[model samples]
Target: MQKIPYTTINGGSVPMMILSVFSMITFTSVYGFDSVWTEWWWTYDGFSGPAWWGTKWPICTMGRYQSPIDILPDKLLFDPNLTGVVFSSEKKINGNLTNTGNDITLFVDDVIVPLINATSGPLQYVYHLHHIKLHFGHDEASGSEHTVNGQAFPAEIQLYMFNADLYANYTQAMSSPNGLVAVSIFLEVGKIGNEAYTMISNALTHIPTKGQQHRVHGLPLSVLLPQTKEYITYEGSLTQPQCQETVTWVIFNKPIYITEQQLTQLRNVNKEGGSHLLIFGNIRPSQPMYNRLVRTNINFRPKTKVCSMVKEVFYEVNTVQTRSGR
Candidate 1:
């Protein structure tokens, strides 16, 4: 039998040094180099294999009792007490368009909604509108929400609001449903085009791909709201990741329209530093029915009071202390 010679380095075994170096390289490749760990390992199920983890943790498993759900008009019941009053200060705002290859940014304003009111129940919660974001796609049919007749709209705008008192940080609110409310608006391609697009588009030249800071003046949210005020309401969650089921969705029946050229400019926006910001479709797919009810509301008229018959589920998470002691 032949014997292999042992090597030493700095009063230690050389083999151990080689092994340590190999371990470090493996660790760096798996974690330090990229975000693969966050995408796979840090999820609900620990990383094992594609099949094992995928089965254990499907898409909706991470959701709480409530989540972001799509509401169909026919299924909703009208309610006068649960009405939401729409108000805007007519203040112009601006932000940088950080188009980082995937999502495009437009009018990321610092909005503050000091007040919100809801009906009494588990869903009775007040929140604030923190900021608003706009996303446009290549074609009119590539929006987030599709019509019941299976027709896609032109663009989608997400008004991201949060419980200003509950979670001081946006990231915390995103991970859990209790602190966020996203009002989504679908835009259609019309012959007249949308006037709201003009307010942001005329300033597009000032905002470059890498993110040029642009200002908007007198761009009130009322311009984007549906005139009819007839909306489909449901108890859902945020559409983004860590999909918490804590949002009260109010989807308007009518849609706003924008021209093809305005849509092109919005799609061309890039994130800061010349990143390849590809503003593809940013809307999440419609979620399950989940034994939830959809409600609707019309103008205030002399009619009998009708209550929403939606099924409600109790979430046992400890309530956080708020300034209002809610």
Candidate 2:
């Protein structure tokens, strides 16, 4: 990590470590500017895998509020106060999609791009879209970071937004309280391909290796999201380094669709130094619940599948409402 030199009263230079609030890292798969073009510091396996994250960033092991939790339908509390998240998307947004070595990340040009933000439903302050990270596994059965009753999706799109009302920039917001809102949308393989995702897939050829970037222009941000806004909300930490517990996670209840061909393209993207080894399995394992509260607006009584595995979790659900309120 390169430290910028700070000039003191005596004109002497002092090394200062970059202290980004959220990991000072918006994410693993990320959200802030501090680590836009940094080299691969940590990994998904081997010596620097998730298991060893705490050795360098202690919060990964010590923190009570970790992320990527397996959401059991039976272990969810239905919050009447919870409505859909209020999203404001730019009609057309411009950004650069970069292969950040470990994950593919998209960062918007805040200057040229009109403000794309979201508020309400578990959010207290207005959050500005900072970055987007794509996480996947080597195969279909093990890609998504967050699982449902131990069932993982093909991929996960993590849209990291920082509180614009509370902080000046993504870097500053990442370190503050009520700092970030990570909107997670799962991707399922389907016959039809989402146009927004198609645009991304087409652009993948331009950035076939690490540290490469492709300019994406005139993209409809709303097209990237599913029609439904219903989601499960929780208070958790970033899935990356520093693992700050300042994030509010909004995981969409409904999944967006993508094509199998697109999935293959992502799996084909080469890792650092343009090695033949494709970039795959960049997801983090699910963390402990730690007695944290998980809230949702979706009523699942009629749709609930009996999962005896989740018998010990604590939650509140309206039996009468689900039975009568259709």
Candidate 3:
């Protein structure tokens, strides 16, 4: 090679030293070398694909192993021994039916349940009964967490209880997977002649609209449970916001009836400090069925399938199918 001029650094002229400095600058991008290096690396055959980019930075995508699943009938199992369903007949408050934002607390008594067996593979935990309450909305079709098939019920009575002993409060039970269980009861319309109606109807006068408060007692919880212990059970999350995935849902197959006047009274309650919350409907769209299972206890009579119930009613009356085909 021809003789080359050596670069001077400090007090020395060293060719290798100059080359080392240049290489370092090239890699570090002290000059324009860093950009060139990045372009070269990114264009390399094995490193240029989307897979490589994804491996480096994952985006919002569902993972097959931990994807979200939907609650379906097949995933549920019914148990019969879980019976003695009773509705409370106590009415604790009486005031303006529309404005009263009273917290109606109902007690569940003699609910005998078993400890959740988490060691049993998929059916690890069995959710026990807890107390339930109502969050009133301003419409006939709203206020419940779920609907029968697709129809929204007038009011939703959320029976709250946890896996822990019935003595435990909601705060304690919600802390763990085995802590809480809620049975949701949807209130429908029409006359069924239930004694429990007096408990709620008596208080309607006190709950007029938003910002009103009423205090009452003696509301029974048993009146809301299905006559048959046969209920569809599944692993689900609380229907409220910040939906925790710890709830074991037991939705009664049978629905309680309410009068049109009673439903109107419920629709006038205040919601979240706003105007009387006119909740026309409250329910989530049915989700896709995953590989989960729903089981019912064997002691009680089997409940009619929700689909069949809808079909029978529609056909019996020869009711014209609405555009939505409900």
Candidate 4:
């Protein structure tokens, strides 16, 4: 097996390492810009595909555990034995934000880095937070990569982690079947903006053009995740070209809210090669689930409990009003 070379550096100084992990990487140039034209080549037109994958990128079309599947609620298996995720406590970590023309990525490095680790929850190994990537669409209506029971969201955020017990570096880990784990969070349009996303969003101004990057300080991983750990787990492949069937996916049940303006900013970011052309819909369409069983820890109780709670609240409020004689 060929080993991928990787290193850690502070202040956004490390050079981009090109590897066979993702085929679109071959399009990166010496100046750190990736061509928008090259990124568009691999994207599938819709939910199903014997994609542009077979002829050139065969693994994607042939891979059994392909990702971005439409998760059917009725099809999920309720697994009581699945352990809940225990993540490292929230803290600030130094990182860099960069635009690859297709998506925005943030890398967590070791400059005053806090120890970040997560265990259990369908994982056979402990994993550490490696980095983050954001996926969105050209329009507000349909940008998310993964859909819930055929419903698509405005965007999605993926937190990539490496099995610390197995491989020493993240890049080296992607080649193996159990090497990588990604926690996916869906993003919806709402009135309030998420403060956790501000660190990366603020940095976008400095790196508005493709291939350009800016170093970020004090990004807290704690703020980037959902308040609850309710998620659906399944085995799947990377959504990008040279799609490897190595990821253990954990898609959170609830979505974090962001404003419409913020969504627009993400859609309008420039592609690599420094063109004004905005890259829209940077997501792979849903693949076939085949026979994979998606397991979840959430046990949706019967409607009886919901009604009881509402009735109790109403009774308590009515009693208070009667006591006041109003």
Would you estimate the TM-scores of all the predictions?
0.62, 0.81, 0.53, 0.77
- Tens-place lDDT per residue, model 3, 78-187, is 44334533333232222222331233433333322222111122223444443446654456545554544445556667665555443254556664665555666666
**What lDDT score goes with residue 19 in model 3?**
81
Residue range 226-264, candidate 4, lDDT tens digits: 788677888998787668788999988677788888888
- In terms of lDDT, the poorest run of 10 residues in model 2 is 317-326
Location of the lowest summed lDDT over 10 successive residues in candidate 1: 317-326
Put down candidate 1 lDDT per residue, 1-326, tens digits, no spaces: 86545467678666655777687678868677435433434321124332233243354453434333444434444565655545443544344434333344543445434532222222344555555556555676666542332345667666666655577656676666566666667776667666765676677667655434565656556676656555556667655443456566666656777777777777666544555644455544555565566655543234422312111211111122112110
Of the candidates numbered 2 and 4, which has the greater TM-score value? 2
Task: List where candidate 1 sits over 4 angstroms from the true fold.
Answer: 1-70, 106-126, 175-177, 203-218, 267-277, 298-326
User: Which candidate number has the best lDDT?
Assistant: 2
Q: What is the C-alpha RMSD of each candidate to the true structure, in Å?
A: 11.0, 9.5, 18.6, 13.5
The better candidate by TM-score, 1 or 3, is 1
Clashes of each: 14, 5, 70, 0
In model 4, which regions exceed 4 Å deviation? 1-50, 110-114, 302-326
In candidate 2, what are the lDDT values of residues 4-123, reduced to their tens digit? 765444676544443333344546435434344224568888887889888867888888789889886656777878878988885566799998778898898987322788998889
Error of 2 at 323 (Å): 24
